[model samples]
Target: LFRWDGVRDVHIWLWETGIDFSSVIASFNCGTNTFAKNHLFRRLRWLGHRAASHLATLGYLAIWHGYHLGYFVLFLFEFGCVVAQEQLYALIDRTPGWAEFNAKPIVRPFVWLFGRLTINYAMGSTFMTMGLLKTKYWIGVSVRSINMFTILGCNSTIKSAFYVLT
Candidate 1:
């Protein structure tokens, strides 16, 4: 079910972006060469999940044992990406965003962009969070996790840059 949901999310992403999956997959569309190069990010989001979770568990154990733990937060974020990707895919799939858009056709474009950017934030947030789950301390965490704590930092930066430029 999870795998299906993830694949469905990818399908929706492709569809919402106005791309045809069959043509791209069948080589009739080429997709600018191949799926690997063009879909690496989506594939990474799916494939790297297992490795990321394993890394998080190991890092958690190591930190729990009292160690250098510099990358613990990053490990956590990676794990979170794995989980969040699964969750957000499910959530967006089941959401009524489409219903709202259909009810207000004039705002369909805004809804489309909102959904797209929200989906991107979901991905980027998970990736950026990889920096926070660093090794732990009995009293307090090390400064290493600071870099990972603000997982949405990139989105904010992008928004601000766009606002400033616009």
Candidate 2:
């Protein structure tokens, strides 16, 4: 899926929280902003929705594209990348230090550029390559870049700070 899918999801969650459930899902009112403002529960629900939809879409692609194992692999890696990105977003949003770091005149540009390059490199395989073999090859080539972004999600300092705030 495109990056806009994530933006659309945030909008949907915000919209759903504000409106009535009757105007949405069976009984799951995802838009209850106050109920889950900046909480793990909210993030979990978003991940659930994201995974469910991606699973369905991947299944459709597998069927439509001749049932390649690569489709599943791509979806799996893509899911991890998306989750990592979400965690980073949450970390940056909640961490005052990160906000300060992001605002630095010299540091800001470097971080932004590095972050974008790492993300693009991580996602390149999923977006450009097809079939299990080709996807695997591209991912192997780009794994280093992907690891850097993933490391941000796993770093103890980042997690401790992020969790403490929440």
Candidate 3:
């Protein structure tokens, strides 16, 4: 699971090596103007779109490649957790007395274990890389709103504050 230790590890690595190996959960959109400042990169961004679409199509064929893999893995993880909960309740035989809690020992910590495994590095990389590769798709008001919502959803108001403060 992505507990404090895992986050600490990432921070340590970043501090020691000036490297950021953040996956999707730790990544967010940088504004387009910042990206487009690079002249050659701006032109090449168009080429990236055509290439990404073709690749996305190929990926679509390959078990829809990375996306489906992550999706199904997550599905199984959640399903197994539900089954475990069912068994936990059955084993408990009855609810608690204090508040009559009709459940078993909560394994909430383990919840995010499979979550992290299914949310593997490759899948996250593909997601962000695809987003980056499709600049046109992630630009303008519609995309900007979506990108902003994504960050806000992640509860990362800190980065947005950085944007505003700077």
Candidate 4:
């Protein structure tokens, strides 16, 4: 729900006011948005996919944080989550009646539950990556935690894409 409209409203308010402490604080608050809008997106516009630009932006953010392997791993996992969410939304939008079905009172709760579970799972892995720091340790932990269900869940999109291609 990070809508551009809220950001636009803040930008307009800032523009209408003179430079001040509040404006400076607001600018600092919007640093990520500013960087994405002004730098990464502009430079990667020719990539023709917002996801590519997003991946690049995440990589830049990871680099900005530090040169640690954990930082790169964490950001790459975040990029994957973003792509998965985007693909899920796009798929839902493209399928006739799917959005309506999801919106049904009876179905909505289950959908919300599933989404929450997925997000929690991703967050657990992310926190582990952040805590472990080293690539080998995190990789081992992740590998040990992986299950058949998770593997299938991750590959479902790839399978669907392959099916479409064929």
Ranking by TM-score: 4, 2, 1, 3
Lowest summed lDDT across 10 adjacent residues in model 4 is found at 16-25
Backbone clashes under 3 angstroms, per model: 10, 3, 1, 0
Q: Estimate each model's TM-score.
A: 0.27, 0.45, 0.21, 0.65
What is candidate 3's lDDT per residue for 20-117, written digit by digit as tens? 22332223222322332343334555645633332333333334334534333332322333333334445556544522332224653344444455
For each candidate, the alpha-carbon lDDT, in order, equals: 0.42, 0.50, 0.36, 0.63
Question: Could you give candidate 2's per-residue lDDT for residues 2-100 as a string of tens digits?
Answer: 455434324454333322212222222334323333443334555456445444444554455555556665555544544555566788889878878
Candidate 2: where are CA atoms >4 Å away? 1-50, 127-166
By how many angstroms RMSD does model 4 differ from the true structure? 10.4
Residue 53 shift from truth in candidate 4, angstroms: 1.5
Cα lDDT tens digits, model 1, 1-166, are 4445334323444544632223222332243225333444334455355444344344544465345443454344334444444444556668878555445878777756755665444334333433444333311432333344456464343343233323
User: Candidate 3, 107: how far from true, in Å?
Assistant: 16
What global local distance difference test value does model 2 have?
Answer: 0.50
Predicted structure with the largest TM-score when compared to the true one: 4
- Worst lDDT run of 10 residues, candidate 3, spans 17-26
How much is the lDDT of residue 160 in candidate 3?
A: 34
| Residue pairs with backbone overlap in model 2 | 16-31, 17-31, 17-32
